[model samples]
Target: MLFTTPTFAEEKAAEKTEQYDPKGPILEHIADSHYWHMFGEHSLPLPVILYTNKGIEVFSSHVFEHGKEEYQGNYKYALIKDKIKPVTEAGEIDTTVRVWDFSITRNVASMWMGMAILLIIFLSVKGKYKTRAGKAPKGLQSFMEPLVLFVRDEVAIPNIGHKYKKYMPLLLTMFFFILISNLLGLIPFFPGGFNLTGNIAVTIVLATITLITVNFSGNKNYWKHIFLPHIPVWLYPIMIPVEIIGIISKPFALMIRLFANITAGHIIVLSLISLIFIFNSLWMSPVSVLFVVFMDTIELLVAFLQAFIFTMLTALFIGMAVEEHHAEAH
Candidate 1:
């Protein structure tokens, strides 16, 4: 009987070892974390800054040791599912203390890095323009000149007309920021793979900026079209409300489009990589690797396409707002 008991326990342990679940890990990878994760168990912990009812407290995220341990700040705190929350001495989550986390997370750090890269590239190009002064382009200027020209000639001039120059700065900023952020998310190494664009908060801010710009730039014709449409008097109630909704919906659509596309791309790539582990077969590596490469190539194109689409649409909207209404000659 004793021998049989030991055999049963061994079999159960083997079964547990063989079982694999990929959902938890996949979700964790896509979501934001306090520390910037590198390959395997290596990760750089970011600073943890919190504002609580007691006062402000600052520390390192590593103090929690990936949620395996709790740390004492101004109050007792624990990392609950990658979130810093106050906990009671009884080892339970404390609901009374409200915590405002102002920490620089993986996404925030990546955004700063992206902005720095953009500044360095553009500032160097600016200096070249001053020194060269109408000479043929070379090196970094050659690469960036075409993209800048495309946005101006193909995107801006076509939609926004002569007044396009007024909004060119905004258009350029949106296009390059989105393009760089999307490309950065596709990288699989440290300081590059953080999904800055995929984060919803970032998208919301971008959309809000577009919303403010569009409405503020609206001329008299644009205001008339919204509040006092050229429709029958009886349809005023119906069409007026519709026009108001349309104004808000445009930017809302932009927000969802960018957020969903970028996030889905990252999830698909991660899910593909998880397939080999799920199958528990060395043979699955070649098949999974091939699909991952193919998808990555498609994603590379999509990064540019999404940026172009966003800028093109914004220009179109701005043009609509600023267009002059021409009347028929008598």
Candidate 2:
């Protein structure tokens, strides 16, 4: 039989005078003590969980538990205060979310960075256009004009053919958006701090857009080649399935490649910095910082490389779909 014991009157009085001290090593470790505002050595990978008093919480599994005792099975939350906390029923929190989660997230921070970069490029080109007084372009315009012409001449013209002008706007917009967003991800400060390109949702959306465009833009010849190829009759059945799967898989590959590469770079950089804290060695601090800085530099190049690769592959795929193969004369 289970018995619930009630405190004696004398024991209750003694307990009140003694005071119930909540402070302990476990509490100290779990408490939000560190000042994130101060840019210094004290940084901990505290697991941040979002919760509402109304019974909803979102958080990473990694930092939620401190030890075996702290493990609450699915009950991950540790009560910080008894008071009810107000939170959105669904959607992003503008405040109180952990910085790492914020950094990894795709949000307004990333959107603004992408917009700002595009604005700068367009304004600079426009400025040059005005100064030239209807003459040949110079400076920024000179640099950008060739790229614009190259996309028209090399990418759009060759792939989309004589009717390429119709699709030029979409192609150009996609290329520049991907390029600028990728580049912005490499920046470690304010506008660039958020890893927009690293997020799978963003990549998937972009890939889906490309997939839709490629299939929708296909000509009659494109569909004929995919459904009923010019190959052997016996091979058509097997080849048809493979070819259709390949068509779907290409854009999926694009989504994974971009997302993995960007996310991996950031994780690596963070891991390097985390080493110093893990070791708790003063000597290791400088080395870790230097290594992280070096990695950040490499990421800058990777940003541009990924953007170019994605754009080039897209052009290649479009080229394949639209390329006209004439029947050989007997």
Judged by lDDT, which candidate is best?
1
lDDT of 2 by residue, 137-176 (tens): 8877887788678778877887667767766776777667
User: Model 1, clash count?
Assistant: 0
- Name the weakest run of 10 consecutive residues (lDDT summed) in model 2: 1-10
Candidate 2 regions exceeding 4 Å error are 1-106, 130-136, 157-163, 327-330
Residue 297 lDDT (model 1): 96
* Candidate 1 residue spans exceeding 4 A from truth: 1-18, 327-330
| TM-score, every prediction | 0.91, 0.63
* lDDT tens digits by residue: candidate 1, 35-130: 787654567889898998887788989998878799988888888878888999998999998999998888888888899999999999999999
lDDT value, candidate 2, whole model: 0.58
